[model samples]
Target: MTSSLHLPRRRRGLNRRQALAALGAACALAPGAADATPEAARKLLGDLVKVAPKAGKVKIDVPEIAENGNAVPVTVTVDSPMSPTDYVRAIHIIADRNPQPGVASFMLGPDNGKAEVQLRMRMAESQNVIVVAELSDGTAWTATREVKVTVGGCST
Candidate 1:
């Protein structure tokens, strides 16, 4: 099966070495691109979109203790009817202590039949994770979980 990776495409002009060099140079220019912070995340999220979320009706699943910080499994579920009249619109995962608070985002619809998402998240350190769900009816739900990592990920 030919599946899309959903990764960024390499720029047309630069070769592998040149691309790597350019990427390195660009990262150097962007402050904290190597290490994202919660404040940075707040600013990032604030610029991306505004959200007012309520509590409950959502569940976040992650290990209480992660032996490795490189990759931690995370799952989010929302209690929704999954019908055209009532369905989930999107899910955004945030890590409180990680350099970048925003982790992953998923968009869903009635065709999904359920509101659920599973993915692996790289953590910089032990931190609390928050998941915000947006519904088609213009309502938002949130849930949070804390995970302790023995070792940190990202620029380790």
Candidate 2:
């Protein structure tokens, strides 16, 4: 018996090459398929803070090689007095290669009594993770660490 699923060559939607090309184009244009760049991560930080963040005073504690990108442990600490006048106002975690560069943002105050933030972040691939700490005085500090992921977890 002839199968109804079978279609003649003339009735085929696209040839082999055309089908492949269409697939490639679709993958390229797919949402969340594009990975974020380091420049984009930096631009996100720039948009958050007016002044250029200087390196140091902020420490990023993360594994040099993350076994899995699904949940990579990260700890960000800022050297601050934690006083009412001078304290860390915010801490932003950014994964450069993720679909979304901004991972998490923690808002802190003197009452928190510490300038440390710990969380698990999803990394798209092997790339830099940037941590920016903004102080109450409008000063910003940054720290970057490279984490190599064996298995990428992000949709990108």
Candidate 3:
């Protein structure tokens, strides 16, 4: 007696190279995959920092070398008087090498007490990461740091 459950046959006709090419095409067409490139980060930064004149008093802290790319710590600080009159409105973090370069964005208010942010994110390789801050007065400030990643975490 033969089992009715028959598994699908593997495509032995396709060579390794062809299979790899097909996989690459599929990955490129996948939603969110194509947008996970460094270019996306650039676009995001440009949109967030539209009015360059407003950018000032922003600071970023990043390690020179990240031992692990899976979780690198980042810190951002802004010089502002956390009051209703003048306060940090938001902070944006972008990693150049990561698949999703747009790491995080934090929205702040006067109640935050201070214009500071800290978080951990994944890095794909060695590249510049930018941090931008926006204030209630419609001013923006940015800082960048080059982070070296020993092992890439975005890709296998």
Candidate 4:
């Protein structure tokens, strides 16, 4: 009997450079292409959560000044009972000046015991950082803090 060998199939998609070029073109043609400022990011966050204001309780912990922008520590804490009836459903972190304003989004459950999350991320420049918390009761709360970066993380 003749031995049969199998070869792995190559991915039929654009390579790295081609993918980047496609992404750049898409971003250039997207709406509000010139409005990637901090204010715009905040407004986008507000619209995403679908909350006006004064809903749940949220807080953000971060240093006022960062020596390095490559990795800044951030923590979000929500004041909620975390019971079956009421609990924090999700937490979203946004870095204003980053190429992608949306930094991190975390999902929580009552088993988490506490509504808190900590992470380190890169920041493009000095700007306001927003933290939004969504509760099980369909309410959302937000908090923001300005962070000064001595060194830039994103490309100039």
Candidate 5:
């Protein structure tokens, strides 16, 4: 007896060239797939002009214990007047355990009223989240927070 339900099937007809191309693409992404580590996080920080950013004047808000790994709330606030002369230039959020350490970055101008940013990010595992704020005066400040995750997000 044939059932009335129908299901989609994957196309598996691939020639040698197509198979090689697919294999090459998979190989190309293999390294990047496993590149997320503490060292990767450090590499991202090192790429910045100021790797050794001082810790101060910035507050990073993240849940101390996150049950869901996906869509974790993150907020970074800088203590600044946000005047034309003094304001936050950029804010970089880093996730130590994500597929890529560089989670997101927000660029702000003097016209922006406040030096604060709020967004959501993903966490792979329990790790420290770092926030770095670059000011118009060529100064960078950073803050770090450890978050515990019950389930993993990326590569899980």
Candidate 6:
């Protein structure tokens, strides 16, 4: 009797090792496996903001070097009066080089008390963190911060 590993070529099936290798190769050649680029991040920003975001009023607070990219602390603050007439309407966070650039978004109003948000974000690698704050006056402000990640967190 022929052993399973030595079956006739016409009836043979992929072994465990061959199957894993084929799967890995297929995944490597699959579309959309590449990480998000700066342009992708910019495109996402454009979709959220009608006009180019001005570089002011928005601030990003993050570490210059993150020991771990998993759950890295992030804070986005907008210098807004937080009044009904003049307040932050939204806050968007983008990771320029992450697998998926869009990190988080928050909708706010005068009732939120302050135009600040704090959260932890996973990063795939060292990249720029962008913050855009849309105000009630149909204007958007932005800020960027670069963080060096020693260990990536997105995959883990």
lDDT, residue 80, model 3: 87
What pairs collide in candidate 5? none
Ten contiguous residues with the weakest lDDT in model 1: 1-10
lDDT of 5 by residue, 52-97 (tens): 6788999998899988888788888999999999999999888876
Error of 3 at 111 (Å): 0.4
What's the TM-score of every candidate structure? 0.72, 0.79, 0.73, 0.73, 0.76, 0.79
Runs in model 1 deviating more than 4 A are 1-37, 43-49
Candidates sorted by lDDT, descending order? 6, 2, 5, 4, 3, 1
lDDT of 1 by residue, 1-156 (tens): 123333233333346769779855653445554545557655655544466778898998889999888889988999999999999998888887665567888999999998999999888667788888888988888888889988767454
Predicted candidate 6 versus true structure: per-residue lDDT over 1-156, tens digit per residue: 567556755354457668879865553444444646898899889998887899999989899999999989998889998998999999999999876789999999999878999999998778999999999999999999999998777556
- Where does candidate 5 have its weakest 10-residue lDDT segment? 1-10
- lDDT (Cα, tens digit) per residue for candidate 3, span 1-156: 133333222234356668889865664555566677668887888877776734458777889999888888888899989999999898988877555668888999999999998898887677888888888988788878889988756544
lDDT of 3 at 15: 64
lDDT of 4 by residue, 78-122 (tens): 999999889999888887766668888899999998999999988
The per-prediction CA RMSD against the true structure, in angstroms, equals 15.2, 7.3, 8.9, 14.9, 9.9, 7.9
Which digits, one per residue and each the tens of the lDDT, describe model 2 over residues 1-156? 355556655456568768889865664454664646677787888888778999999999999999988889998889999999999999988878776688888999999998988898887679898888899999899989988998777544
The alpha-carbon deviation from the true structure for residue 97 of candidate 6, after best TM-score superposition, in angstroms, is 0.4
lDDT values for all models: 0.77, 0.83, 0.78, 0.78, 0.81, 0.86
Candidate 3: list runs displaced more than 4 Å: 1-38, 53-56
Q: Could you give me the TM-score of model 2 versus the true structure?
A: 0.79
Q: Give the runs in model 5 whose Cα sits over 4 Å from its true position.
A: 1-33
Q: Indicate which candidate wins on TM-score.
A: 6
